[model samples]
Target: MSKQRSDEPEIEPFTGPAGGWGSVRSLAEVLPRERVAPDALRQLARQNKPDGFMCVSCAWPKPADHHPAEFCEEGAKATAWELTTLRTTPEFFREHTLTELRGWKDYDLEQHGRLTHPLRYDAESDRYVACSWEEAFDAIGASLRPLDPKSVVFYSSGRASLEASYLYALMARMYGNQNLPDSSNMCHESTSVGLKAAIGVPVGTTQLRDFEECDCILFFGQNVGSNAPRMLHDLRSARKRGVEILTFNPLKERGLERFTDPQNPIEMATGGETQISTQYHQVKAGGDIAAMMGIAKFLIEWDDAALSVGDPPVLDHAFIAQHTKDFESFADAVREANWADIERESGLARTALEETARVYARSEAVLGIYGMGLTQHVKGVENVRMLVNLLLMRGNIGKPGAGPTPVRGHSNVQGQRTVGITEKTELAPVEKLKELYGFDPPTEKGLDTIEACRGVIDGSVRAFVGLGGNFLRAAPDTDAMEAAWPRLDLSVQIATKLNRNHLFPGKVTYLLPCLGRIEEDVQASGPQAVSVEDSTSCIHGSRGKAKPASPHLLSEPRIVAEIAKRIAPANPRVDWDGWIADYAGIRDAIEATYPEMFRDFNARLFTPGGFWKGNKAAERIWQTPSGRAEFLAPGELNATGFADADGRFRLMTLRSNDQFNTTIYGYHDRFRGVKGTRDVLFINQADMAKAGVEEGQIVALESDAGDGTTRRREGLIVTPYDIPRGCLGAYYPEANVLLPVEHHAEQSHVPAAKSVPVRIRP
Candidate 1:
């Protein structure tokens, strides 16, 4: 057989509403080829149901009322991909060497199929061999027992269910390790830190129901159509209800511009679509903070002018006075922000900012929704805080239809954090763990994702255990990470499919196959259901009905329990077997851990649509040091101008419509009008002219990290796109090699993947 080759990417302009017959056709093509069973439609129907499996693509909240089909095209692709009949057994691994596998693209590696059995690396043979669960567990235990607990870093993916995350956290703490680095560190850590500082909470305050009541909604740096397709339904409905939707993004996302719900048969058949965004502002890359501050300044000026005439004040004076603090300082900062600086930084006119402010001020209830665009920046925390400052000016929080909402990427990422997966070991969860499991949790701050990578590079982290993620490919500075990964004494990955991470073996590597979310998980007691928290903080049960991909597969909860049993056999406090046998017991423990928040956890699962976890910000109850919502002011507006002296473009890494996180479903990005390949860069037409480059010119991209360390990706076809001048867009993982590991958000420590300074080489 010959080596696989990607076809040349074909680029064209797409002009249609997102999610219509096109999505339906795409789903049809993938489903049949994946050998989806006849009952696959039934299984899809049950998705997002109270007692059914949750879509593994995104964390958008499920509606209170269930539709016949609650899943999106991306969700369908994820499900079909998971349920594919292909299997990667021992023979498959024997046929392909690690070196050969390394040559394949990320999509091909996972597309090869589901892992069937446990495998261990045979360094002498340079291949993986079949290993029993007992042997793998024993080897892991022996390797971990000798190493200092601090030398091991336990990392988790957001895809892990609440039960698995809870058990993984417990197992790590019981083993006396606090280095818990999760996927959230790379994505939403900025939102957590920013929101915690401003409103005393890390989660979004807006509920799904709030969309119904919102008069105006602002989408900052988020592409709702591609990232979270289901969100378009809410936007379409809101638009129909005369709700004004304002969009601020560098690219003109079709989902935010116009959307045709695939679920609406009449609209799909008639080729009718609803316009989503009333006003679309093309902000520059890393300019969200400036745009937000500009809006705040306009609102403050309007309020002052209104108050000077003794007329009705534009600002919510009563709400601000009663429910907030530090208003004077925050207002001063907004007032002092210069318009010229804001315009230069945001790449938007002053009149546009004033118009947005006018719409916001006139609306009784407004909602601000953002994604990684706002969070994956050098000053990501400040960007989020500035957004909150804008909303606070009108008292948006703790009210119906108004608040700040950070849309999470992964399906259960928010749930994983809610279930105690954090580097910081808080007193309440630590005390609860001691009471329930009799283990003293670590008190010291642990390593985050970046710190974990640094630890691996410095040889401080010897053993690595991953619970469901492709850490090697997902992390930044691919060259550095690849170099650091082999230094570990042992590395283990608990995953459902074969990813690039598995090919990068340590001294002793183990690949443990776990059941996918679409498969039945039969525990010692019986079939079990795991719960996940949505972006809106709704806790619901997800029970898979599909058959297991392989009989050798073990549930994630069971794997964690067995691993803990081997590593901490002498710890008599916790009954690992008991917890794995039944997941309800785990929920009971979660209730004990967060008594006030998760009271009656098991019973609440039976509710028609899941129970809300309840946010204090939603209730107008502040939990900050001042016992009120605090207005955190941002610093001076210092935007990384569109281009540098050397004509370097500000490159923002993005995901294609056919991809989720590190998982690539196909080579086509229907919405973006790219097909057949991923090796392409979306550049503005003017930038092409300025750089003396033509359309479809293959160019090399070199990072301007300023560390004298050269990092570059060669032979990338330049496609002129509808983007801001001097700004370029490229797919992640493929472009991750250009990002420096040390370049990250100031306070959140998240790698600034969204805003990397790079220069093109012809």
Candidate 2:
């Protein structure tokens, strides 16, 4: 932390995007801010039993022990957030109305605290009043009954149990609407769609143990330290073992730099940090396909030269011949690829690109890990396939410590999507669910987060219900989402605490408080257990230690079950109560629904560290249409730049150190030296000169998203940094304003946060 400078900003010249550079520097003006602490901080601090409960914050792999340095800053924030002594009770809401609450800032709304009890907004009273759990459930049932099934949307957050998620999907499907939208629809749906299309499975290629035996790791667009910091440990371990972890990103992040693991007694005592990324290439955002193709080209050409001599070949020719198809065409495509195009589009010198290729060729085993940075682009799916193509070129898919690794966010997000929580159009899942639950699930495609927002505004949607996540705030085009949510007949959120989304109440809003993941769930049978799947695709048990924050707070499973039990076929055949009381019955149903994955769910859940599904360790038996890994090469490539007739820059939205997804924990990003605010930009120095802008200057952002929405942020900090030229970046969902819902990847409905053609104006 440092003091703020009132004047005389010494930002290096912006060489990246026009005008946006000046906005990057104003970040210096707001220096060193901290979260104002609540009266009491409820902390587990990674020291309290490692086997207790997984941190709801980030997906950092745990080794089932009480290692002192298990948790990172973000993990701590998540723990504090969940266990915070703060409460958002009915009395507090009684003083506030949806109209008055609409004026509150995102931070203030979350800062007021957790939801203590079930609350129903009273229109006549102009405030929220406390209601009993039964009454709340009844109100939900009443609202659910006669609306066209298509008019209702059932949504879930990633931080939910497997039992809860299954029940939620079952409940919605039983009520005749399979319009299930979830947090994954916003983040990793691209990974699921693209990877499943390419590889048979829809998750990452490498599991936890792969790090120890790997020689190379390809990192694309993932800020490991800030987002999933525990992964830093594996990288650090691999680095010590002489593995080359290549980082390809537009910006140089601090976490990617040498990390001093606080738990390493020697490092902490000696003030030492382990070097994580052996080679860091500043590739332009959305330019990964070109760079990846360059690797395949180098492998083919290098192997040819090697075989021509008396030397061994660079490629595993035997492996390629055994598994892949179209090698000759692939070779010709790479051979004819324009090096100039690759260099310029990638924003990397030819020498640097060749060096990365040389390293990748030398390593026999490699794991390419990516995050939203790759998926939030127009070429997101292509980028995924390109990475797989590079692996297939030399047969890097099935061997030890080699393959694609899509590092996912939201602890159980992968599982949520796996259990039919998708808003996809196919009604087969609905039909299957109907056959199981004795009711026909709606066949029409449901609204995703964006579509739901639009539906509310268009009057197509009568009510919007979110089982857990923050709907209004998580959406792009904040004004539209904020406005549209209130237009609904009934808007409801099942939350643990007060958040900005709760303030955006519709004509009728219900804020039903639920139990946190860390709280013990006592059921009719007795104390129960829940399950969550980590990013590695390993499902494990989670048993909470503390009692519920309040006795009135019900588990999310119970809440969803109650909602289901209330509004189902009048005299439904299935016993929803019997399943809710005993979570295993829910697990048994999950077993029947997904026997290949969840066989004997309860029995295996009690096993040490739980179970690993058919995952990374399962080898390369892809569940794709062809029952094998896939290779795809797009006919053309798109470059990074927001240029008009004249060259400008495209601003890419990013996450700051302070926030997690849409949750505003605080207004400080410790790694980037950003503090006291979430509104700032990062730009290259030379571009500032070209645009005639100075540091600490306020500027308006203009874009061509074609949604007729104007996204302008004044007083933006223009800091000089290592982002690629002709491009700019800022924090999201704040920067999501620049992204129109209409601007998404061609294949996956994911918004292109990686590339938004925009220019900053003075």
Scanning candidate 1 in windows of ten residues, the lowest lDDT window is 1-10
- Candidate 2 residue-wise lDDT, 1-762, digit = tens: 111333533333222211121222322221212231332133354212335677776654556534654555666666666666666777776677867887876767776667788888877877888888888788878888878878998888888888888888777776777678777767776777777777766777667788887899888998886788777777888999899988898888767766776566686656576777788998887788778777677777888888989688887778667665566776778888888887777777777878888998888888989988778776677777777778787778877788788887787887777677877745236555655666666666777766776676678998877888776666666666666777788888898877777776778778888888877788899988787787877777777766577778888888887888777665455777888788888888777777788888878874544477776324766666666565666555562323333445767787876667877777656666666765576877788777766656556576666556776655566666667777787877777666666666667666777888777765
Q: Which candidate is the best by lDDT?
A: 1
lDDT of each: 0.87, 0.72
TM-score of 2: 0.91
Give the alpha carbon lDDT tens digit for every residue of 1-762 in model 1.
112223566788887779998889889988986777777888898888767888888999987697788998989998988988877899987788998889998888888789999999998878899999999999998889888888889999999988899889888888887788888899999989989888988989988899999999989988887789989888999999999998999999988888888888899789998999999999989888888888889888888998999989999999899999999999898888899999988889999998998898899999989999988888888888888888888889988999999999899999988988888865228877878777678888888998998888889999999999999888898888898888899999999899999989999999999998878888878888888888988887889989998999999998988888877646666778888888888988788888887899888875656789889888888888999888887775643422455687789998989889999999888889999889888998888888888777778899987889899987788788999986899999789898887888889888898889999875
Measured against the true structure, the TM-scores of the candidates, in listed sequence, are 0.98, 0.91
Please estimate how well model 2 matches the true structure, expressed as its whole-model Cα lDDT: 0.72
Which 10-residue window of candidate 2 scores lowest in summed lDDT? Answer: 14-23
